[model samples]
Target: MWFFSIAGVGVIGVLIGGVCLMAQRKSLFGVLLSMEVFTLGVYVVIFSMVWFLSGLNSICLVFLAFGVCEAALGLSVLVSLVRSTGSDYVGSLVLGHF
Candidate 1:
């Protein structure tokens, strides 16, 4: 559990730094991919919490389910956005389309 938490934090930090330097995630697809990586870190932390607390594994499972759903939703939105705008620009998602 502790290992997972530490690994999650470390990887997330690296990811953030890489993302900041790359500046290549100017599209919705790249944004969603980053979000999924972030979600994975969250899942690891949550799993560690549940493990130490002696709680039910259901909590971890539920979070995993949500992550899956988020990935699916992101992909669908990306596809639709591309179809409508002919591009997967991140700006479109933030321009009050919601």
Candidate 2:
């Protein structure tokens, strides 16, 4: 029951994040934020599953490492984008692309 609830929330989070990503693809910050949310949902789902199953100890650690790497990469991309554009607006950045 708890597993299903957590998984459901994660699925919803992913859907919302996907929509945000598709709508704001031009903005680096928006993309990064959306990705973060999506990843967090994934982590939540996985964590719940692991907790319910009483799985391997290393699984959670591995997920944590992945999350850290993702955050670092996302932040780096956002910084580069901001440096180049001087604005965080997705629409403006996308308009400049062409």
Candidate 3:
């Protein structure tokens, strides 16, 4: 049924996000990627719920706008940090570096 399909997608998203987050130990890029995966999962779940409740509307649009902005800002910051430090390793970002 449709309900099962939705739940399956939600579960898959959560699993993907969890796996990506676990990979974050390798590099800052991994961390960002994982966060994006997690965000995707959140979006999927929210949109699904909204779709079931009231069809589509401005709420989905607003959530999408904010999600895009968040991802952009996060990636920009990551790029800046990498450029300044010459490395994407998580530990490279120490308080004293700033």
Candidate 4:
């Protein structure tokens, strides 16, 4: 059951990433957001697996730290994009060197 749940989450994350990639076409913000979502899903799945297999311990702290860093970097990029473009709409910016 746990294995199935993890598999389902992984599949969903992959689908979301693929769709986002297709729609946005190498968009940095889109790719970042998709990656964040994928990362969160993977983290949850991994944590659950860890807990189920070995019970919780200090090792989980590593996952927590990674998630925090990923979120922080994502947010920083978002803020930079907003500040530079004055908007969050990806369509407004053209592809290529910014």
Worst 10 residues of 1 by lDDT: 17-26
- Report each candidate's C-alpha RMSD, comma-separated, in the order given: 4.2, 3.0, 1.9, 3.5
> For model 4, what is the error of residue 23's alpha carbon versus the real structure, in angstroms, after optimal superposition?
3.7
Question: Cα RMSD (Å) between model 1 and the true structure?
Answer: 4.2
Query: Candidate 2 clash total?
Result: 0
Q: For model 3, what is the error of residue 38's alpha carbon versus the real structure, in angstroms, after optimal superposition?
A: 1.0
The Cα local distance difference test for each model comes to 0.74, 0.80, 0.79, 0.72
Question: Is candidate 2 or 4 superior in TM-score?
Answer: 2
Give per-residue CA lDDT, model 4, range 37-84, as digits (tens). 777667666766776788766666887788789878878877888888
Give me the candidate number with maximum TM-score.
Answer: 3
Off by over 4 Å in 4: 26-29, 89-98
Q: Per-residue lDDT for 27 in model 1?
A: 82
- Pick the winner on TM-score between candidates 1 and 2: 2
Q: Lowest lDDT 10-mer window, candidate 3?
A: 1-10
Whole-model lDDT for model 3 versus the true structure? 0.79
Better of 1 and 2 by lDDT: 2
Q: Flag regions of model 2 displaced more than 4 Å.
A: 89-98
Give me candidate 1's TM-score against the actual structure. Answer: 0.69
Worst 10 residues of 2 by lDDT: 89-98
RMSD of 4: 3.5
- Candidate 2 lDDT, tens digit per residue, 1-98? 77899888988888888888788756677788888888878878788888889887688789889989988987876677677777766566665562
lDDT of 2: 0.80
